[model samples]
Target: MPTIVVDVMPKAELLDPQGKAVAGALSRTGHAAISSVRIGKRFELTVDGPVDDELRASVQQIADEILSNSVIEDVVNIDFGDAEPAADASTEA
Candidate 1:
């Protein structure tokens, strides 16, 4: 099975009230070193087979249409867990 991980977050320009409240609480609790926090959502999907281009497109569509709000939220990342890491081109030399 192949796993697709999607991370969704509010746009950087938008205010994050929950995150701000949490940060304030942390500071009050003596964790002042932490400057800020942004809350986000993560979705893990296990598909039947390898992640191909078609599947990738479908997943992107799903993320845009259902998993996230394009108005105020954005899909930060989509990761295919079964895919092999690309070789670092710089390391080839």
Candidate 2:
């Protein structure tokens, strides 16, 4: 199985209220050195199949369709699994 990890964030063009809230709270708590903080989401998924181009596209589609809001959000990263399988299991080249 291949695992896909996604880091989603609000689009740079849009205003992020949650991020502003965090920044405000930080400044109030004496963290004035920090100017801003952008809030985002991370999602990890286990996909069953080889980590090929098709699988990568599918994972991207899933992220765009369900994991992120295209109107105001953007996907930052997608990482494939790195675990090595046991010798008994078949692997893709």
Candidate 3:
């Protein structure tokens, strides 16, 4: 099986309330030296066939159109996760 990993995050201009709360909690709990935290989402898709160009493109489209919201979020990354050889990857957003 092949797996594609998608990572989505809120746009830089927007505030992430959950991340902020976690950061505050960490600071309060004495996990010092942390300045900020921004949380994001990750989606893993396991596929049935070998990874190919068409499959990759479809995944990219899905990531951009379905997995993330263009208004508030960006599809930050797509990892091919052992389905293909590692290379320098392009960020989708």
Candidate 4:
């Protein structure tokens, strides 16, 4: 089994009101040290099967196809978990 992590967010060119609201709160906290803040959603997917470049590519493709709309959306960051290789012992010595 392998785990896949995907992050989907609005493009920098797009307007993010929610992010703005959160950012505003930052200043209220008396933390002027922070100037800008962007909020986005994070998703974790667990897939059972082989963990290879092909699988990762497919996942990214899916994110672009259905998960996100490139028109006003952006998705380029993706992460994959460590998969344990199949175990087999050699009896021949």
For candidate 4, write residues 1-93 as lDDT tens digits: 667766677889877888888779989988798887777767788898887778866776777777777786666466666553212211112
Residue 8 accuracy (lDDT) in model 3: 89
Better of 2 and 4 by lDDT: 2
Using TM-score, give the best candidate's number.
3
Alpha-carbon RMSD to native, per candidate: 6.0, 8.2, 2.2, 10.7
Q: Which regions in candidate 1 have their CA more than 4 angstroms from the true location?
A: 83-93
Can you give the TM-score per candidate against the true fold?
A: 0.84, 0.76, 0.87, 0.77
lDDT of all predictions: 0.81, 0.76, 0.84, 0.69
- Please give the distance, in angstroms, between residue 11's alpha carbon in candidate 3 and its true position after superposition: 0.8
Tens-place lDDT digits, model 1, residues 1-93: 777888889999999999999999999999989999999999998999778889977887888779988888878777767555422211211
Ranking by TM-score: 3, 1, 4, 2
lDDT of 3 by residue, 1-93 (tens): 877888889999999999999999999999999989999999999998988889888888898889988899987778987655435444544
Instruction: Report model 4's TM-score to 2 decimal places.
Output: 0.77
lDDT of 4 at 42: 74
Query: What's the count of clashing pairs in each model shown?
Result: 0, 0, 0, 0
Across residues 1-93, which tens digit of lDDT does each residue of candidate 2 receive? Answer: 656787788999888999999999999999999999999998989877678778777777877779988788877776666564223211122
Task: Give the higher-lDDT candidate: 1 or 3.
Answer: 3
